[model samples]
Target: MNYTLHQLEIFRTIAQLQSVTKASEQLFLTQPAVSIQLKNFQDQFNLPLFEVVGRKLYITEFGEEISETAFKILEQVQSIKYKSAIFEGKIAGKLNISIVSTAKYTMPFFLSDFINANETVSLTMNVTNKMAVLRSLENNECDFAMVSTIPKKLKIERIELMKNKLYLIANRDFNSTKKKILLKDLNTNLFIFREPGSATRLAMEQYLIEHRVTIRKKMELTSNEAVKQAIIAGLGISIMPVIGIKNELQNGDLQIIDIKGLPIETNWNLIWLKSKNLSLVAKAFKNHIELKKEAIIQQHFSWFNDSN
Candidate 1:
């Protein structure tokens, strides 16, 4: 390899810390030395990796791609180093994890419990949408990801973590003539939805398609919080993760419809690269969730009328 591992390491550090000085301190090198290493790595790519303006370094477009690739390269190198260290028997490293946004509500509690139990380890979490979570996992940007959507043909191992049910929620102001709502009844009603590529949105779409329900165009939103706000303001109904809307339902800001025979089921899975050697932290997390999956699901979804 023409590019030195040190060069890739410096680039990765700068990308993460976003400052040469911070990268230098973390790596225990002088700022000028860090700058020199970054420049050398940029030269290897034949492109300026970062743009400096008024003492602030912003990663360029191409730099972001390089930084992502460099992250994977450096992480693989670290795994090798960790293996070598394990020959002497030691365990230490931060485990980086990412999860889709809708899955965020429960992840913190479980993750905190795990971290508290494992004093020798720490974790970094990236809360993003489905596409970003997939991208992060594919680029080795994260060690593992908890996501609702599993892509076809991706070389990843997935362990079912939990089955989450979907709920059609609306504000009290939503006045429907029918007692039991049907998919076709929502045609005239306003609809609030997660942006394209959201698994919840996809599931809802698939259900509508399968039932041959024609939906009127309404609002498209990105976050569950935004969808909740719109629903609370009487904008429309939405198909949302039951876990995500528990507080709203309890507060009476939202009401779940007893829509019989509608598509109401989904699952969350823990995903990781099949080809990449699994880290101890990642394996532990996967095992922990697998073992406790049933209890967690029961605790969360027990109150629902539809127990299945």
Candidate 2:
């Protein structure tokens, strides 16, 4: 079979995702291009690789074996590239990080300098909720994780990068006749929340418990962007990291509510399992963050002072 490496890579992605649309999205290729390439690859093999039943794609038994082979081949090819780079004495390899979704708003600033300095290093950042990110870290699926809430169950080493400040936010049209808004005053059902297992949600819940805050009405959204939009739509107020809502605040679409106890703060942290051995690339990346994070913060996040 005269199959190209591109065809092998595309086949691996399709096998893993089980959908042409999803594979195309992940590969940043058009759906039709993915479909055509898939057909061309399948034409080389006599046995069917995949089948569609009830509008769902299913890999054939032989297809599963081929997919595994494809995965190993791609992995070996990548290893060869990394070995070549190492022989040249270059700081090169992949850096995989699992991060709480909100960290997507700020962690790039902390990573920018190192990433720019090491042009050959590949970065894969998986942004998800805190629980999922922690799970990834616990499974050793990533080199590091960026989070605000430190986990108790893991023995980890961490560098505190910056402060994550969460404030009670409302749409600009939200009524605020009183100068001093008490937690008890927000006793209505007009509260919105991030989904449970979110670090921000946990922080909000902790503050609510401390102040005995209660809301008669509440709804849940799974992402920072969603919660921000819900608030902008005047659906309800929510506690969100200031970093995630900067543009909205600047645009006057949202306003911060200064209640008796507000702006719950936590340190943004980069953490890794203490027991895991670090690769040269991971160690170099860690060193870069530890050394230059302060300058990066000061340069990119100076507006944080005014965001408050």
Best by lDDT: 2
lDDT of 1 at 137: 87
Q: For model 1, how does the per-residue alpha-carbon lDDT over 73-100 read when each residue is reduced to its tens digit?
A: 8778766766665565655456888998
Number of residue pairs clashing in candidate 2, backbone atoms closer than 3 angstroms, sequence gap of 3 or more or interchain: 1
Q: Write the per-residue lDDT of candidate 2 for residues 24-102, one digit (tens) a residue.
A: 9999999999899999999999999999999899889988898999999998898888888888888889999999999
Report the number of backbone clashes for model 1. 0
Count of steric clashes across candidates, in order = 0, 1
- For every candidate in turn, the CA RMSD to the true structure comes to 7.4, 2.0
**Estimated TM-score for each candidate:** 0.68, 0.92
The lDDT, on a scale of 0 to 1, for candidate 2 is 0.89
Cα error of candidate 2 at position 120, Å: 3.6
Candidate 1 segments whose C-alpha is farther than 4 A from its true place: 1-91, 298-301, 304-308
